[model samples]
Target: MTDRDLTALLERATEDVVERDFAENAWAAALAARRHRRRTLLTGVGAVAVAALAVTAVQLGGADHPKPTPATSSTTSTTGGTLSDGTAYAVMPQEGTEGQLRDFDAGLPSTIDVRARAEAFSAARPPGSVVAVYLRADGDDLLHPVLVAGDGRHVLMGDVDLVRTTDASGNEATPLGPRAVGGGGRYVVFPQRDHVLRLDAQTGDTVSYPVPAQHVEWAGWNAAGTRIVARASEGAWSIDPSTSRAEAVPVVGGYEGTFRVTATDALPSDVRVTRFDEDGRPLMSTPVRGPTWSLWGETVNTETLAATGAFFDQNVTSKVIRRGYGPIYQGLLVVEPSSGAAKVLLAPENPDGQTGRVKGCCTVLGWADADTVLFQSLGSHGRWVLAWKTTTGEVFEVARITTSAPDDPVTPIALNVGRRS
Candidate 1:
């Protein structure tokens, strides 16, 4: 930009200059140089003054200076007739209470039986008190995901319909099917009847953007969850719930595959992986090698697998490859390609000698950002939990599904960067 344009922008940025700015001199010098380059006869005095003012405002935490806070992915809240933020979630008893849920009815359709399924099919997470989803079975084959949560004492439930669907021939239709839910900061985004549903995780309030076509088959918030993008049989479109606009993006890679990603220097390096030809022929063995099951973080260097959350108890057969799978029963690792170095950050709290199942379980869900990775652990026979790990090795148990105790039966719960409709 020209010096004059730059000056204007800087002026807008420093409208609230103050005394606390220690960088006043720096801004002045920078502006003085720009003014000289522009060949302006005006004395540098005015530019210098503005620079000094801007710096002071910066240090004083003016409106131009916004504080940065750690990003919040999701939060669990209860509705005691209303949401935590005093939004009306419950009209009578807020509709979803332990008693009301016990005496539940979605009133979906006589064809859709919320009663029988209420007794036989139910799902929860965080062991007993967090984000949950359920399916109400009926005479129809249709099943939609419902958001369920509790605050230790009461169970809050809400209706979410999955009316958008696709046939085997890629035909779009409005019918009940499995629904996919993606969470963003302070809210949850999902595909609803015929629109993109944005639900406030805390307030239980909702806003929706109409689907761009007859049936939007897939949808998700950009990495930051600040915006929503969806796909229909016609094509992919980006949606802004805040503005209620949907626009078509590029089709070569499909806008449906795109998401706003966090900026990161941590690249998903081929250095740590093996590349094989289409026929399964070994092509390239990289610096850091992973086993049969491994995940690579997303592109743009914003985030990739920093390391695995679990340990594989096995000896390295060779620097190039590890001969067999050891049950990753311990967990996985993020391997350093440079020296084939890896750190086992996740392991079972209580190690089992024999009869023990793998902890630090399942695969990497996907990277939320450069420093974070989501995963699943199904070691608990009756329960499977979702977890997240940061580059610092701090792990958090986010949600889980409760089930009958069996030898690690497949938990319906799953985590993913993206799952196409």
Candidate 2:
């Protein structure tokens, strides 16, 4: 086919695919058939025409038309086992289980803790229960009291207060002095200037440190607890607990968004920084594209750039390249650290009150492993479904969990999955 014809055909096919709302599978099948026909036409054309036509085809298709490696089988399984309540669990790839889902009758007071750092943390039980939970605590007061997991079985607790107390004796407890706190085992108290103490939840050890007189904010830890990110008067800074090394990186632009050190070392590449004015209006927006350093392997992938807003905003931009299929819109694209290949997972469309319309959105809810990605989709009637995909393209439907009440929207609490041990 001539280059013009090929371009026209691809565009028409894409438009049709979108209008019909073809799922990823159907889309792939249709593309493959069209590709075969294009190849056949190219073969039948004369040699003199082939040279010019081939170049045109290549240019029109862009460099993203290389055959994508088929998705490999994933060992990761996302099964929602029965909870203690005898209700079948709806499992997502997540770190810990929800206690509320397991036993609604039980009134377990959800525990919260303020970690020294603000990082992505996961909570899960040993096994034999469907009460795993994971949560990202950004510093927003409205969402501050958010419950990561309320399932009644295994509860992953967070957002607790660091308090000060005294003994039976009238002697006043110094701010830096160790004190016992209820619900906390062996509390280590540290001073944060003005009679304020910093306590470590994981370890009871406490220390005295200087914090600004004004309200102090806690960011989370990096992959390693060695580095803790915190916000103070000067802005955000990374503090190395071991070496006491502290350095200020550029302040993250968001007001109250969660910060997570991805399990992999992929540093934020292709950052689309948007600065806002005092009135929450857009002032400036710029895109920074570069190689992102991976945290796990420490390798860098310059093949594609990832995007995030520089300052805080509700929406962010992202890019993903799908082989053979070309670029798929509104899908989450993640590059495998091990193979350095990109995998594009389609997100469901917004449900516009149409049954069987296949309206749902997908997010890289969490990582099942370095190679496997766990995704969640909300089907019609607010039903929740979980699926797993590997870098190689294999996709499997794990289970259908539950639906959110129209009154109560169930935001993803936490997601983590792995091969059953």
Candidate 3:
């Protein structure tokens, strides 16, 4: 069939079938039967005929037709009700009293009101013995404080220093060498200055290991206190404390993305670009610039992974890659950073849906584990409370820890980040 004839047949086939009718006469049937004509045209014209017809349709304003507006329902608000700050706030469970838990801005100074009465103690160290320290949180009881202090030398949790040795008096301080403060008040005082010290804050007991000072820098640690990323003067290394050995890996350069220590050794070999071969076969080409590293793990049982990369286009923006198990437990979950919002692309499992705005000018500060990510939301009063997200992209409440005594006045919660639409 000629090109014009095939085009007309295809166009008619795309229209409503009920709209077109024909008489029972043979010639009339032949003119009305576009389906039968299509089969004959497709068989004779081949692939080039299809491409030409598509191009013609686009040129004739066919492809530019507006799509039907999708139907949508009201968004069900999760835990926290929408606050006046343009951010959402929710109340989480606390071990203390019911009023002990309060909602505050994750991006600004907020007061943590505690009704319990308790005594507070402060720890002091001699000049050269300690370098620097900061407070983490202040609670009515002694456990949660807002201020956390640490130097490249030692980490102090509450009234105890992970690296310090006490005299006859009950005191602690860092002897100095290289030490890293892991979560849960645990410190890995490394194989430095001839000893590795593991001190128990509750009992004030210390366990010392004898090893050579191999030079240490802050390598990120996992929640289990097993997987740790440390950079020595030699190269990039990961030490699994559970196995008591270090493995050397290539230096992955770029924005520091969240890392996880897996139960098995499986990570993506490399990240490259999407390209086409000379014969037009699709392939992945080597990355021209930016970092090529796996953010998530590679094992079949692996639950989550996150990585950071830079855009090569005009804006030259930075972005993060997060892949996790989806809500329904089918495929992976992905999120991309674009302009002012995070574009979440669900894997094959989700039927392609997007999320509303997740407010704040934030940078991922740390990862609690494979399931939770902590982000530092920048706002007016310095760095405020951090924001955390579950593997399924669900956000928890904003927790504000106090830096002073428990009786001190609390600051107002700042909510500047807007919701996504």
Per-candidate RMSD, Å: 23.5, 22.1, 26.8
| Candidate 3 off by > 4 Å | 1-197, 208-215, 219-229, 236-302, 307-372, 386-397, 401-421
Clashes of each: 13, 47, 28
Give the per-residue lDDT digits (tens) of candidate 3, residues 118-141: 223233431111111122233321
Q: Name the best candidate (by lDDT).
A: 1
lDDT of each: 0.29, 0.24, 0.23
- Model 1's alpha-carbon lDDT is 0.29
Give the distance in Å from residue 16's predicted Cα in candidate 3 to where it truly belongs: 53
lDDT of each residue in 98-119, candidate 1, tens digit only: 1111110110110111122221
| TM-scores for the candidates | 0.39, 0.35, 0.31
Instruction: Answer with 1 or 2, whichever has the higher TM-score.
Output: 1
lDDT of 2 by residue, 228-341 (tens): 333333344344344553333334432111111122223443323233222122334343222222111011111122111011111121122222222112333333222222
Off by over 4 Å in 1: 1-158, 163-186, 192-195, 200-218, 231-235, 247-251, 254-289, 292-374, 379-401, 405-421
